[model samples]
Every structure is written in structure tokens, then in C-alpha cells.
Target chain A: MFNLIRRDFIIQKRQLVMYVLLILFFVLLGRQDPAFIFLLASIIIPVNTIAYDEKPETNILMNSLPYTRNEIIASRFLGTIVFIILATGVTSVLMYVFNRPFTTTDIAISSSLALFLLSLYLPMSYIIKPGYSAPTALISFLVLAGIVPPIVSYLGERLTSVTDFLLNLPVPIFYTSALLLGIVFYGTSWGVTTFIYRRKAF
Target chain B: MENVVEFNNVTKRFKDFSVKNIDLQIQRGFVHGFIGANGAGKSTTIKMMMNLLQPDAGEVKVFGMDYKTHEKAIKERIGFVYDANVFFENLNLKDIKRIVAPAYKHWDNTLFTQYVEQFELPLNKSIKNFSKGMQMKASLAIALSHHAELIIMDEPTAGLDPIFRRELLGVLQELMLDGNRTIFFSTHITTDLNRIADYIAFINRGQLVFNDSIHDITENYALVKGRTEFLDRDTEKAFVHINRLSTGFEALTENVSSVKRTFGDSVVVEHATLEDIMFHLKGGLQHV
Candidate 1:
């Protein structure tokens, strides 16, 4: 199972430099939110790894190996967490070295959002046809980005009592709850992907 | 004889095609060649053996164990090669080996290095740059390095130059030097089987026609030729299918003796090659 996870790194060895450069590009150029930059850094590697894995040939190769379908999916979910931590750590160091300002809150929010985005993307990648999932994910992310804020704000304005109760919660507890919710979604996505993958025919 | 793989009443259905009720057994310590035309469910059967595609009905077993309970154990003992390159195309052979070698518990690096040298494969060159033959050699090298007891390949010799095809056959023949190894490979090229295959399993149009020894297949099936007048409703029972030309008629028969007995020296009977058998059988069995 570790071998399966390590496969992503080996496959993308040449692109490792590019990944670093991509993060640096964002860090150095755009005046984007530090949290958003961190989110991009966390997402680049795992999502790119999926792009390679979504191919039929890759699936055939992985399935033909001694690993079970459960083990394969486990590696992907576990590997996503591993890369999220590693990429976030690396980005933090880069931010520190550049003397940029980022708080623990920034790390918390970005990592949680990373988990949420990936939880949704991983299962959808398996469900969608190969060569199209990346675009589908991009389009859906854009659509959600455009529409979700308005919906959430509208609901917040309409449901004052619920919004007041949530807003009254302590900051640490709120962030912790957000992180916990991300974990729940991640776990459910893992189960869903494994189910879909087990029934899939090569 | 110990059976390395078995399929019992296995059926897989697709909207447009299906592999119907197949019962096949592959013995240990022999080379079994699966021969069929394009879209004949050869790959489907091979995929079921690998557990890539589960059967809609019935069971498939390997090494006397079912896949549901022993998927990893079964796969660990069996190595697979598909019709196309399944390795990451952009990665070189060495990196690919690094990724694949650790998956098996008994991967032999020395044996892998030997095959790499023997096949003249470049370690640093990306697989995308390799020729079809080289890509096949790469797959074979990995499949062999694991010390797998059963090596299952689907269309390994398709789209290769004749020389490389012969070379691949020679490599497979050498692998058979180990008395415990068994090879099951599918191919449309019937001639390759004549060189090394000890048993032949012929499938046509999603149905298994026969899975028998080369000696039995050759002994049972033959080509009979004579004037068209020799073929009658009663006499036609001897032949599986018949082709009538303006000059004469040539037919394939599973019973060589019946053909001789019915014609009484009027028709010439010749040993049918694998091609002849496949060609005649592909025309659909005649019911007389």
C-alpha cells in the first residue's frame, strides 16, 4: 500500500521542481489571500497525482498488482492527507523564509478547505470518465465559488437566530468544528470511492 | 495433474456482447495459448482471471482459491501482461521498476537485471520512447522478476515484428525450463502457438470451443477435400463446416476417421493447422 502511494512521487519526479516553482510563483507574485495561497499549495500535488491515476492504463496496472481494491483506495485517501500535511508544511516554511505574514488561523482554514475540496474531487474523479474529471472539477469549483457565497450570506441573513448562535460560538471551537466537519466529509468520501471502485470493471 | 486456474460456468454479459458459460482449466507446468479473433472475449476471460472484471454469474478460481477470499494471495502468485503498455509511459524503466518491484514480497533484483541485460532494454530511457517489442520485453522482464508461478498475458504478441515475436516465444520457452512455471497467453497469431504452446484453448464469438492438448486438437481435427458431389446431407455430418468452390469442396472435420470412412478414398484428408481449424470454426458450426 505504501508502494502504491509512493508511486505518485516516482511518476511525478520530474514535475517536483515545477510544483515548487508553482507555489513560489503564487507566493511571490499575486496578492492573493495567504489562506488561498496555502490552499493552492496543498491541492497542487494530490490533484495532479489523480490526473495521472485517472487513466485506464494506470488503473489496470494498479489493479493487476498484488494490492486489493480496498488497499488502493486507502492509499489514495491516506496519501492525500499525507501530501496535504507535507505541502502545507513546505508552504509555511517558504512563507516564513520570505518574511510573509500568515497566522495559525490561515493554516487551519486552508487545510480544512483543502480536505473539503479533495473529498469532493476524489470521488467525482472516480465517477467521471477519464480525461474529463480535472476539467469537471475545475468548472464545478468555479461554479461553487461563484454561487456558494451568495447562498450562504442569503441564508445567514434570513436565519438570524441560527447565524447568531453560530457567530456566538468561540473562535477556536468554531474552527475546530469546521476541521471536524471536513474530517467527516473526508471519511464519507473515502467510503463512497471504495464502493464505486470495487464495483468498477477495470 | 494439478490445475493452476479454473473457471466454472462463468458468464459475463455486456449490452452488445457476452462471454457465455465458460468452463476452462489450465494445468500447471505447461504453456497454454488462448487463440481467438478480435472481440472474441479472450481479454475478458483473461481479465476475470486477474480479477479486473468480475463475472456476472459463476466462479473463477486460481491455485484452488476463489478471488473474493484470496485476491491478494492469488495476484501475488500470478503476473499479468496486457495487450497495451500499462506502465506509466513517461517514466523510465528504472523508475517503473522501483515502483513495481516493492509490490511483490519476492521480487528478485538480480533476476530483473539479468532480464534487462538479456532483452537489451535501456534502464534510463522512458517507456514512451521504446518500440512495441521493447515495451513487451519490459513488461515480460517485470512479470518474470517476481518469481510468479503463473504468468497470464493478453495479446502479448500482437502488433510485434515477426522477429520479435519469435524472440518473445523463445523467452517464454526458456521460462518453461522451470518445471513449476505455467504460462497462459492470448494471441490471434496461431503460428506462435505451434512453436511453444503445449495446450491450446480456442474461443470464438464469446464461447469456448475447445481447451485441449495440441496433440488431441491435431488428432481430432483435419481438412478433407473432394468434389462437391461428395458432400450430401448425410455425409455432411462428418464435417464441422464446408466451403464449396467451382472446382471442389474443402471441409474441416473433427472426426478424421468418419471422413475417411464416408468418402472411401474418394476424398483427400490432410492434417489441419491451427489456422485451418480457427478459420473453419469461425465460419460457425454447421448443423446437418
Candidate 2:
């Protein structure tokens, strides 16, 4: 699994420089709303790296290796965490350098959304051809971004008792439960992708 | 001899074509040549062995272990080269080696470096810049570097010049001197296999037409050329595959003794080449 992740890095070595520049540029431009930059920073590199694997030869080369299909899927899931951490670090440092006013809530919301987006799209990339998968992933992201908040607000307004009960909980407990849910969702996505990949023929 | 690879009633189906009930056993310590025309399931069969393609039915076993259950263990001991290069074309040789070498437990850096030097591959240049033959050499270098017991190649000789093709055969010959490693490669070029292959497995139209020792094929089949008038209607039916020409006709026949006895000095008989066998067996319109 580590070797697979290391391969992704080596293949993207040329794009690594560009990744850093793009992260810094987005953070500085969206200083007022750091979540947009944070989301973009976390997801761009992993998604782009996934796109590189669209070629049939890469699949043949990978299957020819000794790694199990589960390990390959595990690597992608683990690599997403790696990407999330790196993106967060770069974004936090740039925010500090620019004296941006961003709270912990900003980081949590954006990172969780980024993770959710990744968990959704990674399986799609494996199940479908990469050419269709990449554009579909982006389109799905746009649709989610457009619809999710309004739906959440509408539910909050309609179910005041449920929303109030949740808002009244202790901050730590609420955050911990959200984090647990995110982890479960990510783990489930990993298993699902592995299952799909194991059955797929190159 | 123990078998290195076996396909028992293996089947794969697509909308238009399918490989049905292929039963092949590749014994250890020999060079096996897989020959076929275009779209003859050579690549499909190889893919199933490598577990790149799933067999709809039956099983593929490598090193006596089921491929699906022991893919990692079996693949570690097997090296493969595709007809077209399978590496990232944008990456240089060094980068590819770094990515791939760690996947195999028995990878030998010194051996890989030697091949790199022998093949005259540039470490820093991207593979996209290399010629087709150079790319093939690079693929062979990687396949050979892992000390793998079984090497499976798909048309490794195509696109290569005659000089390199001969050189590659020499390298395969040297690998066989150990008398343990098994080589399986598919090719349209019969001359490449004529020199080194011990067994030949011929597939045509997704069916296994012939699988035998090169010696047996050479011993059993003969090319018979004679005047068109010499081939009576009854005699023409004896040929495995016959080709007609304006003045004379050539045919491949297993009953060479009978043909020789009947035609006598009117016909010329010679040992059949692999190309002659493949061409005649393909059974198409006349070729000039």
C-alpha cells in the first residue's frame, strides 16, 4: 500500500510544484472565505492524480504487480487522508501568513466536505472509465454544492425541535459525533470501491 | 515435468467474440510460443493468466496455485511484457523503476541496471521519446530484472528489427540455460519461435488449433508444391490446407509419405516452416 501511494507521488512529481502554487494562489485570493480555497486545495491534487490512472496500460501494469486489489483501493483511501492533511497544512500556514480571519469551524466544515466529495468520487472513477468519471465527479460536486446547504436550511426551519436539540448539545460531543460519522462514511466508501475493483476486469 | 501454468476449460465472452474451453498446460523449463493472427484470443488468454481479465468460467492456475486466490504470490514470481509498453509514458526510466521495483520481493537492482546498460536505455529521458523497439527493450529489461521464474510476453518481437530480434532470441536462449525458468510469448513472427520455442500453441479464431512440440510439428507436417494438374480432386482433399495458383499449387499435408508416393517426381516436398503452417491453416484467399 505504501508503494502504491509512493508511485502516485512519483508519477505526479512534475505536478507537485504546480499544486503548491495553486494552493497558495487560491488561499490568498479567497482570504475572506477560506473554506472555498480549503476545499479546492484538499481535493484538486487527489482528483488530478486519480485522473492520471485513466489509461488502460496503468491498470495492466498494476494488475501485473504483486499488490492485491484491496491494497490498491486501500492506498487510494489512505492517500486521500494524506492529501487532506497536506492541503490543510498548506492552507493554514498561508492563512496565518496573510493574517486571514478563519476559525476552526472553517477548517472542519471544508475538510469534511472535501473528504465526503472524495469518498463519493473515488469509487466512480474505478467503476466507470476515467474520461466519463472525471467530468461526472466535477458535475456531482457542483450539484452537491448547490443543493446541500439550502436543503439543510429548509430542514432546520421545518424541524425546529430536532435542530434545536442538536444545536443545544455540547460543542465537543457534537464535533466528536460528526468526526465519527465522517470516518465511518470514508471507511465504507473504501470497502465499496475495493469490492467493485476486485470484480472488474482490465 | 511440473507445469508452470495451466488453463482448464477457461472461457471468456464478449459481445462479438469469445475464447471457449481453452485447456493449455505450459510445462516448466521450456520456451512456449503462442501464435495467432490478429484477434485470435492470444492477448485474451495471456490476460487471463496474468489475472488482468476475469475468466467467466473454469480456472487458471499458475505455479500450482489458483490465480484468483493467490494472485499476489503467483504474480510475484511471474514477469510480463505486453506488446505495447504498459508504463507511464511521461515518466523516465529511473522513475518507472523506482515505482515498479519495490512491488516485487525479489527485484534485483544490479540485474536491472545491467539490462538498462545493455539495452542502451537512457535513464533520464521519458519513455514517450523512445522508439518502439527501445520501448520493447525497456519492457524486457524490467521483466528480466526481477529474477522471475516465469516470463509471459505478448508479441515482444514485433516492431523490432531483425538484428535485435535475433539478439532478443539469444537472450531468451541464455535464460533457458538455467533449465528452470519458463518463457511464454505470443508472436506472428514464426522465425523468432523457429529458433528457440520448444512448444508451439496456435490459436485461430479464438480456438486452439494446435499445441505440440516444435519437433512434432516439424516432423508431422510437410509443404508440398506441384503442378495444378497433379492435384486430382480426391488427392486435394488430403491436404490440411491448400492454396491454388495460376500454374502450380502449394499445400500443407500431414500425410507427406502418401503424397510423395502418389506424386513421385512430379512434386517437391520440404519441411514445413511455422509461417507456412500458420498461413495455410488460416485458410484464406490466395496470396501471391
Candidate 3:
């Protein structure tokens, strides 16, 4: 499985250099948006691979090889995580070198959030085709921002006393909670995608 | 029969076209020529047999194991190729080796080198720049270099020039020297099948029209060219396909002996070549 992920990652090696330029370009804006860069590329890079898969009509070739469809789909999921880890690692070094505003808490928070976003998107890709995944992703992104952000902000602002209490807890507790949430969403998404993929005739 | 591949009442549906019902069997140790016209559900059935697509209705088995249950193990021993260029456009042949080499633990780098040399494929050039024949060779090399028992190919030599097509078929013929090796190659090229296939299966519009050994088909099936009146209704029953010609009527059938007995002197019992057979099988259409 890791071999599959590694193969895909090697194919997408160009994206790495392209992403670094974007991160370095953004750094000149006077604020550390490595976290944002990390989040943005997490979705875009994987989708690009999926798009390339569609472009060359390579899925038929991949399907013929001695791998399960589930294994192939699972590789996409696992590959995204590997990319996220690499992106986060690169961004962390940049942040440390430039003495940026992204502290450890921000990195942890953004990383988990990116994983949740990836989980939500992974299944959409298989449910829909990759060619349409971009527009669908954009529409869904708007819907999420419309609904989730307000609800989250309301719970954070209106329930300030409780929120502040939890926020002020030892950072490890917050980190662990965030980590578990990310894992649950990822596992759930994997289950949903695998189910859909197995049942898909093509 | 120890068949390498079998399908039982399989059905697959696409929005515009669907394979209605399929029952197929290919025995181990002989090359089975899967002959079908374009869009005739040949690739679909092959895909199902290999578990590239799941059957909507029935079962597919390879090497005595259910395709669904033993997909990974089955895949490990089977190699497949499509007419389309499967490698990444940017990568050269060398890069493909680096990536796909690990997928099969039994993959032989030495054998790969031999195929490359035999096919005269370039080692350093990117595949995007390759001619259609070169691309086909590269894909075939990858498929053959893996230590696989069965090789499944879809339209492998459909569009290549006669020279390249023969070259490709020559390699397959050489591979068949090892009697343990088997192949199920699909193509519309009847001449190619005539040259190499031990058995031939003709599929038309998702239905298996005929499945038998190549020799049996060529000898048993006859194209009787005569008048409609020369052959009565009884004589026409065994004809799989018949059409009225200006001279008379031409019919295709497998029971050449019965046809001969019925109309001994009046009808010409021409031994149908694979081309003549597939022509009638595909509604007797004229094809290159």
C-alpha cells in the first residue's frame, strides 16, 4: 500500500517544487500563511493527481494490474495524508527559520482541520468523477463555510465561558482531542469511499 | 476441464451499451483468440473475467478461484494490456520500470531487458514521443516481464501496420513455445487470429456466437454459397447466418458434414477461414 502511495507521490513530485515557490511567495506578504498554504495544497494536489488519472485515461491500466480497487482507492487516501505530512514538515521548517507567527498550536489546529477537510472531499471524488470534483468541491466549500463556520463561531463566541475554559486547558489535552477528531473523520471517510468504490461497476 | 478462465451468466450494464448475457470458458495451456468487432462487449467480458469489472449477475473464476474472493492472488499471476498508452505521459520507459517493477515480486529485470531488446524499444526516450507500435511494445514488455501464467490483451494489434502486427504476433508465438504459458488476446484482426490462435471465440453484441478450437471452427463451419432454392428451409436451420446473394444465397454454419450430405453437389462447402467466420459472425460485414 505504501508502495502505491510512494509511486503516486513520485509522479506528483513537480507539485512539491511548485508548492514551495507558492509558500515562499506568500511569505513576503508579511504574515505567515504556511498553514493556509498547507490546507490549500492538501486538497488541490491530490485532486490534480486524480485529474491526471482522468486525462490520460489511465484508470483502465491501473485497474488491470494486480491490485484491488479498494487498495487503489485506499492508496489515494493514504497518499493525501503522506502529502499533508510532507507539506506540514516543509512549512514547519519555513516557519521556524523565519520566526513566523504560526505557533505550534496553530500548526496542530490547521493540520487536523486539513485532515477533516480531506476526509470530507475524498469520498466526494469517488462519488462524483474527478473532472467534476473541482467545481463540486468549490460549491461544497461555500456550503461548508456558510453552515459550519457560523455554528462553530457561535459556539465559540456565545458560549465564551465554557469555550475559554476548554481553550485554556493544558495544550496536550486540546491536541489529543483534535487528533482523535481528525482520525475519526478520516476513518469514516475511508469507510464511506470504500463502500461506494466497491459497489461501482466501473 | 481445467480452464484458466470461466464466466457463468455474467451481465454488465452501461448507460448506452450493456453486455446482456455472457458464458465463456478458456482452457489453460492454449491461446484463445477473442474475436469481436468494435463495441461488441469483448473488452467488457474480458474485464469481468479478470475482475476489472464485477459481474452484475453471475460468477467469474480464474485458476479455480472466484475472481471476487481471490482478486489479489489471481491478479498476481495474470498480466493484462490495453491499446491505450498506460504509462504516465511525462515518464520514459526507464521510469515506468522504477515504479511498476516493485508491484510484482516475481518481476524479472533480465526478462524485461530481453523484451526491450526484442521489441527494439528505446531505453531512454519518453513514451510520449514513441510511435503507436513502440507504445504497444512497451506495454507488452511490462506485461510479459512479470512472471505471470496468463496474459490478457484487448485489441493489442488492431491498428498497427502489417509488419509490426506480425512482429508482435511472432513474439507471442515464441512465448507459446513454453506450453505452460497461456494467452487470451482480443482483436478484430481475423488474420492475426488465424495465424496464432489455438482456439477462437466470437462475440457479437454481448453474445457469444461461437466458442471452439480454431481447427474445429475452420473445418466444421462452412460457407455454403448457393441459391436460396438450392438449400431448403431444413438446410438453413443449421446456418448461423444467411443472406440472399445475386447468384443465390450464402449461409454460414458449423455442421459442414450435414450440409454436405443434404446438398452434396449443389452447394459449395468452402472451409471458412477465421476471417470468413468472423465476417458472418459480425453480420457478414466487410472489414479490413
Candidate 4:
């Protein structure tokens, strides 16, 4: 299973340098939100790895190996978490080196959002066709980014009581709840992917 | 167990195609050639053997263990090469090795290096840049490095030049020298099988036509040519399929002894090549 996860790094070794530059590019631009930059950083590697894995040949190769279908799915889910942390660490250092002002809350929000988006994206990748999953993920991400803020704000304006209650909660508790919610979604997605992949004939 | 892989009453159905009621046992320490025409469930049967596809109705066992409980254990002892390039095409062979080697408990770096050298495979070039033969050689190198007891290849020599095909067969023949490794490879190339295969499992229209030793295949199947009138209703039953030529009637018969007994001096009986059997039987059991 670890070898399966490690496969992403070996496959993307050349792209690693480009990933670092991508984060640096966003940081130096000094225009996007630090949280958004962090989220982008966290999402890139794992998602790119999925794009590599979405190929039929890759699935055939992996399934033919000594790894079980469950283990293969497990590796992707766990590898996502691992890459999220590594990406966060690298993004934080870049922010610091560039003298950009960012808080730990930014990291918290970005990582949680990254987890949420990936939770939805991972299983969908399995459900979608091989050559199209990566594009579907990108479009879905863009659509969500465009619509989510307006929807949330509209709800915030309309549902005053619920908004008031959520707003009244302590900041730490709110962030913690969001992080816990991300974990739950991720775990569920993991199970769903394993189930889908098990029945799949490669 | 004497059989390294067994499929008992196994059946898999696609929307328009199916492999039905296949009961095959691949014995240990011999090369078993799986031959079928295109889209004749050759890849489907191979996929089922590798556990890439599960039978809808029956059980598939490898090395005396069911895939449900022993997928990893079963796969550990088996090596597979698909018809297409299954490795990451962008990565060089060395990186591919790094990814694949740790997946096996018995991966021998020296053996892999030796195969790389023997096959003249470039470790630094990306797999996409390799020729078809090189890609096959690379797949073969990885499949052999782990000392797997069963090596399953799907059309391993499909696109190679004749010389490379012969070389690949020679390598497979060399691997058989240990008398401990079993190979089950699916190929429509019957000539390849004639050189190295000990047992031949022929599938036609999703049915197991026969699973017999090479000796049995040669002894049982023959192509007989005689005058057209000689192939009447009673004698016609002896042939799997009969081709009525202008000059005479040529047919494939599984019952070679019956052909000799019935025809006597009237007909000429010749050894049926694998290609001849496949060609005739491809018409789907036309006894008449």
C-alpha cells in the first residue's frame, strides 16, 4: 500500500519542481488570498496524481500487482492526506519567505477545504470515465468556486437565526468542526471509492 | 497442488458477449497456450485468471486458494503482461522498477538488471519512446524478476517482428528449464504456441473447445482430404468442419483414428497444425 502511494512521487518526480514553482508563482503574485493559495497548493499534487491514475493502463497495472483493490483505494485516500500536509508545509514556508502575512487559521481553512473538495472529487474520478475525470474535476471545482460563495452568503442573509447561532460559536470550535466534517466526508468517500473499484472490471 | 490455476464452471457476461461455463486447469511447470480468434473471449478468460475480472457464477482458484480470501497471496506468485503497455509511459524503466519492485516480496534486483542487460533495454529512456518489442521486453523483465511461479501473458508477441518473437519464445523456453515455473499465455499466433507450449487450451465463441496436451492435440486432430463423395452423412460426422473444394473435400476431424478407419486408402490424412484447427473450428462446430 505504501508502495502504491509512493508511486505518485516517482511518477511525478519531474513535475515536483514545477509544483514548487507554481506555489511560488502564486505567492509572488501577492494578489490571491493566502488561504486560496494554500488550498491550490494542497490540491495540485494529489489531484494530478489522480489524473495519472485515472488512465485505464494505470488501473490495469495497479490491479495486476500484489495490492488488493481496497488497498489501492486506501493508498489514494491516505496519499491525498499525506500530500495535503506536505503541500501545506511547503506553502507556509513560501509565504513566510515572501514576507506575506498569513495566520494559522488560513492554513486550517485551506486544508479543510482541500479535504472537502478532494472527498467529492476522488470518488467522482472513479465513477467518471478514465480520460475525462481530470477535466470533470477541474470544471466541478470552477463551478463550485463560482457558485458556493453566493449561495452561502444568500443563506447567511436569509437564515438569520442559523447564521447567528453559527457565528456565536467560538472560532476554534467552528474550525475544529469544519476539520472534523472534512475527515468524515473523506472517510465516506474512501469507502465509496473502494466499493466502486472492487466491482470494476479492468 | 499440481494445477497452478483453475477455473471451474466460470462464466462472465458482457452486454453482447460472454465466456460461458469454462472449466480449465493450468498444470504446474508447463507452458499452457490459450488460443482464440479476436474477440473470442481470450482476453476475458485471461482477465479472469488474473482476477481483473470476476466470474459472475463460478469460482476461480489460483494455487489452491480462492481470490476472495487470497488475492494478494495469489497475485504474489503470479506475474502478468498485458497486450498493451500497462506501465507508466512517461517514466523510464528505472523509475518504473522503483515503483514495481517493492510491490513483490521476492523482487531480485540482480535478476532484473540481468534481464535488462540481456534484453538490451535502455533503463533511462521513457517507455513511450521504446519500440513495441522493447516495451514487451521491459514488461517481460519485470514479470520475470520476482521469480513468480506462474507467468501469464496476453498476446506477448502480437506485434513483434518474427526474429524478436522467436527470441521471446527462446527466453520463455529457457525459463521452463527450472521445471518449477508455469506459463499461461494467450495468443492467436498458433505458430508461437507450436514452438514452446506444452498444453494448448483452445476457446471458440466463449466455449472451451479443448484443453489437452500438445501430444494429444496433434494425435487427436487431423486434416483429411478425399473425394467429395467420400464425405457423406455417416462419414461427415467425423469432421469438426468440412470444406468442400472443387477438386475434393478437405476437413478437420478431432477423431483421427476414425478418419483412418473409415477412409482407409481413399483419403489422405495429414497432421493438423494449430492454425488449421483454429481456422476450421472457427466456423463453430459444423459437423456436416
TM-score of each: 0.97, 0.95, 0.92, 0.98
The CAPRI classification for model 4 reads as high
The residue-level lDDT of candidate 1 at B84 comes to 96
Query: Least lDDT summed over 10 consecutive residues: which range in candidate 4 chain B?
Result: B279-288
TM-score of chain B of each: 0.97, 0.94, 0.94, 0.97
Pairwise DockQ winner, candidates 3 and 4:
4
Better of 2 and 4 by TM-score: 4
Q: Against the true structure, whose lDDT is highest?
A: 4
Query: How much lDDT does each candidate structure score?
Result: 0.92, 0.89, 0.79, 0.92
What TM-score would you give candidate 1 relative to the actual structure?
Answer: 0.97
Model 1 chain B weakest lDDT span, ten residues long: B279-288
In model 1, how large is the Cα lDDT of residue A104?
A: 92
* Model 3 Cα shift for residue B100 (angstroms): 1.1
Give a tens-digit lDDT track for model 2, residues B232-266.
87888768988888978889997777887788878
In candidate 3, position A29 carries an lDDT of 60
What would you estimate as the lDDT of candidate 1? 0.92
Runs with alpha carbons beyond 4 Å of true place in candidate 4 = B284-288
User: What DockQ results do all the predictions give, each relative to the true complex?
Assistant: 0.90, 0.87, 0.58, 0.90
For model 1, residues A32-147, the per-residue Cα lDDT tens digits are 78898898888888888899998999999999999999999999999999999988988898888887899998899889988999998999899899999878877876897789
Give fnat, all candidates.
Answer: 0.89, 0.91, 0.57, 0.87
